[model samples]
Target: MKKIDWYFDFISPFSYLQGELLHTLPAEVEIRYKPVLFAGLLNHWDNKGPAEIAPKRTWTFEHCAWLACKHGIPMTMPPHHPFNPLPLLRLAIALGSSPEVVQRLFRWVWREGRVPTDEIYWQALLKEFDATPEMLDAPGVKQQLRANGEAAIAAGVFGVPTAVVDNRCFWGLDSTDMLIAWLRDDPFFSSEQLRQAQQLPQGVHRKT
Candidate 1:
């Protein structure tokens, strides 16, 4: 079976949207759900999230809503954007980071439109999982989360909802179709044009 490491953060609306579409991948593929902190990625890459910018933030939400409607997937923005995803990430690790747990968390945040900061909903979620905040805060759980973040950086991941297969990273919800094509042994991946594109020289760099 082909293994794909799907790195995502609960704070990313695109991640939630991607989660809903993972089932469209080839049956031979085995997905490894990796929960990473989106903020950690931004810090490491010296970048800002879309929500940190004004106009782009509005466009992002609007585009996501449009995508959901176009794809016929149920999605609703959480009460807030870019809320702390650490708790949700650790909670997923505490629950073994299984696909079921990951999908459940995504749906809770995106479909149900709730955040951990919502005390009542948070408590209900914990009760349903037969867990507690202490469990999510366990030393091992925290370490695993840290490890996931470190591994993500090491893998050259710069964003959430990235699917890494054979060390090649396909990023964003838009890349889903490309990933599916590549998984199905698309010849473009092995063509000479792709090799030439990889060898293309950089024209210029933005001033720091």
Candidate 2:
């Protein structure tokens, strides 16, 4: 399977947008949603953290609102971001199958703008999926999620919505389609060097 590592933050609208966009991929392309602390990655990258991530935050809400309407996916981001996604990341990791959680979280945060901190929001969000908070907060699962997060960082991801197709990192949901185009278009891999190049976060790695 050609694995696409999807690095995303629950708070990121682009990540949310990308989650929705992912539905367009052909089933042959296996996608692995690797939840990472984008905030932490920003802190590690530079001094201006929020200021940098803020635009991404803004971009996600605006574009995704339109995309949701276009794709028939409900989306709303106002008042406050749905929740501190770190916990949800942990939950996804714990679940060991974050596709459903990632999909659901994107809906609640992007489509509803409900913060994850709100117990009521969680209840409502999980209810839609026929799930309960207990599913996300299962025993021994949180610690495992943390480990998965650490593994993402170790893999050299510095931000959310980073997709790796053939180890070529594509950041943001906007780039997702392009990434798929490259993946599906056999001509893209014309050169062996291009195919074998290392693709990691910009500062730490190169996109040769």
Candidate 3:
């Protein structure tokens, strides 16, 4: 089976949406979920999130709602836009509960509009998985998350909901279609195509 690396951060609603659509991938493909720090990547790229800017921030909220509706996924914006998702991410990683508990977390935050602050809520969330809060403070859990972030940066992933199949990266939730299409190709991109693509001048950086 072809292995695909799915890099994401829960802070991104797009990532949550993409999780819902993973079933669309070919059955022959195996997805490896990687939880990375979104903020870490943004800081490395010196980029600002959509919510950090004006007009775009407003558009982002509207767009998130529209996208969720379009995808037919239940969504209600979390009370906090950019709250710390480290605990959530770490818990998922420590438990090795990808696409299940992770999916639940997405729904819990976006669909249920809950921040999960109370210990009772968290215990309830992880009850089925048999995960304990002690796992959050477990040694190397934080380091592992950091390593995932650095590895993502090394792999040219600057955003969440990125799918990497055989070292080719497809970014953003909307790119899932294209990523699946790439997987079906008998022959991937030609060597000449890559050469021509890389030789082209870099794109103009837009001011935020």
The models' CA-based lDDT, in order, is 0.93, 0.69, 0.83
Q: Which predicted model would earn the best lDDT?
A: 1
Off by over 4 Å in 3: 118-120, 186-188, 191-198, 203-208
lDDT (0-100) at residue 109 of candidate 1? 95
| Total clashes in model 3, counting residue pairs 3 or more apart in sequence or in different chains | 0
Q: Global lDDT for candidate 2?
A: 0.69
lDDT: the better of candidates 2 and 3: 3
Q: Estimate each model's TM-score.
A: 0.97, 0.72, 0.88
Candidate 2 C-alpha lDDT tens digits along 1-208: 6888777877777677678778788788888887777766776665343435778656745666777677676666645644467666765665565687778666666666666677876667556666656666775666655665676666766677788777567776667667877778757567666656545335565554
After superposing candidate 2 on the true structure, give the runs of residues whose Cα lies further than 4 Å from its correct spot: 47-60, 63-73, 123-140, 186-208
For candidate 2, which ten residues in a row score worst on lDDT? 198-207
Report lDDT (Cα) of residue 103, candidate 2.
83
lDDT of 1 by residue, 134-200 (tens): 9998999999888988998999999998999989899999999999999999999999999999999
Scanning candidate 1 in windows of ten residues, the lowest lDDT window is 76-85
- Which of the two candidates, 1 or 2, achieves a greater lDDT against the reference? 1
RMSD of each candidate?
0.9, 5.3, 2.6
Better-scoring candidate (TM-score), 1 or 3 = 1
User: What local lDDT does model 1 show for residue 16?
Assistant: 88
Global fold similarity of model 3 (TM-score): 0.88
